[model samples]
Structures are given as structure tokens and as C-alpha cells.
Target: MCNALAFVEEPTDKHAKSDGYCGRILRAQTQGTRRDGYNEFRLRVEGDPENYQPASIYRVTLYASSPSYFRGFTLIALKEGTEGTRDDHYAGKFQIIDEEDTQFMTNCPPAVTESTPRRRTRIQVFWTAPPSGSGCVILKSVPFKKILILLQQLLHYYHYH
Candidate 1:
């Protein structure tokens, strides 16, 4: 097991979002905590306006909690400029815990990986383009615990019925 310490950080850079058909940029953010337990946080991303060519970028962050401290990390995602091909990047990048300037933990579960580069965790940003949409960012924290919760919910629903 690793020594638990928490801290706060932001994504590598900011991003702009165009029509989802075109691609949206991805960003990362990090924050820290003292207690090691199940937690949930939110990330906000905005799209460009209808008159501005439908393009904008936003940042995303990640956080970790320990018995005594908190840690964080971040990254950037760029829109590829295609129609209906903009994919999520955070859902693949690994969570970085930089202590002594070295990334600590590696890949883990509950986080989805795609045919793209393999990553530890992905900042799941749920949003829709302009003209008609409300954005929602699902920042998945504890993968294992989340999976358990999902399973439990499913089981509860399955047996309770």
C-alpha cells in the first residue's frame, strides 16, 4: 500500500469545444483530501456560442484523499475537428500523484479505456453541443467503490423487485 497524502492541482491547460460533430478538447484538474473514503466531485465544461463558430475549451481536474493530505493532477484535450467524431480523452489518461516530482499510482478500474492510449482514469465529462443542450460532467473518483455501489444498486433493484 502507498502512504496516503492529498493535494490540489489543475489541468495542464484549457480547452475549446466546437460542435461534438467536430471534436471537443479535454482538460484535467486535481485536488487533495485528508480522509480516505468514498467521495464525489464535479467538473464543469462549456461549449461555444452559436455565433462564434461553435468552439470553446475548458479544463478538468482530479483529486485524491489520504489520512493526512490531498493530491491532484491535470491534463488537456483538443478537438480533432471532425463531425460526430469528438471523443472523450479523460476516460483514458491515468491519474497522476506527483510527490517528489514522480507520478505515484498507475492504472486502475471503474475507469474506461478505449482503442486510444491506455490511461489510469478518465474525467467523464457528459455534455451536449449548443442550439439545444445542458452539460453534465461526471468526475469518477474511486473506481472500485463506484463499481461496488453500482453492483449493489443493481442487486438491490434485482432482488427487491
Candidate 2:
């Protein structure tokens, strides 16, 4: 699920680079990404994703086991389909927890991105779950790197009781 993701950001936004693709620089679509390193980085959600409360905030953390800092990053909340599949459209809205390091992307689903050209690890991005009956949500993230970037990745989830 991490290998296949893409989005466009407005060029006018000071925080946005507008590579036409937020993660992996969009060049991987033709060339290819660093396939040997998918698990090195991922987004981590801090609660029960399946039982998310309507209109509540959930904390999403960027986890990078790699020593490399990303050029940028983008996080999106995608609604889980009927059978754990992706719904195609974004699920809920994203909140910028670290205003100094992150900015909200102007997308219909409303994602968040890194404000600076380079970003450190473990920054948090908050998300508001959709209203009642919104079902489950899957948090996806793609760490941006112009060269030798890893593919997009889904969140590393920990179920809460």
C-alpha cells in the first residue's frame, strides 16, 4: 500500500514545492523507487483507527527508522473501503500539529505537508475523524526526496482497547 500514492500541491504555497507529486518526486512513476526500503519509514497513528470517534482528533506520527531526513512529507487520511480496501477519496481532515514544521495542503480531503525543504523525524500531524458512520480510516504518508526516495506508505497502527 505504501508504494502507490501521489498528489499535487499548489505552487503558490510557500511550503509547497509543486513537483506535481508530493512524495517520491513523481519521477519513480517511470524510473522506480527504492524498493529495498519500504519499512524504514511510515506514519504511525496513536489510537484505535477502526473505532475513531466522530469529529474527534487523532494523533499521527511520522516514524523514520532511517537516519536520513526527508526533503518533505505529506500525510492524508483515506477512508477504508468495505473490506479494508482504499476508498480512493480522502476520508477526514488533517490538522497541523507542528505549525513551524508542517502546513496544511489544499486538497479536497485536506492533507498536511512539511513547511521546510527538509524535515526531521517524528513530527506529529493531527486528524479529525469524520462524523458518525464514517467507518474506519487509514492514514497514509509519503516522505519526500527528490532522489532515491522511498515509496509512499500506510500508517503503522496500534490497536487500542
- The TM-score of predicted model 2 comes to 0.59
At residue 92, give the lDDT of candidate 1.
22
The residue pairs in collision within model 2 are 2-152
Off by over 4 Å in 1: 1-40, 46-121, 124-126, 130-144
How would you encode candidate 1's per-residue C-alpha lDDT over 38-134 as one tens digit per residue?
4433233333222211222222333222321212222222222212233342222333233332232223221322222223233333222222121
For each candidate, what TM-score against the reference? 0.24, 0.59
Kindly report which residue stretches of model 2 are placed more than 4 angstroms away from their true locations once superposed: 1-38, 48-50, 81-88, 107-109, 147-161
Question: What is the lDDT of every predicted structure here?
Answer: 0.27, 0.51
- Which candidate has the top score in lDDT? 2
Model 2 residue 63 distance off true place after TM-score fit, in angstroms: 1.6
Clashes of each: 29, 1
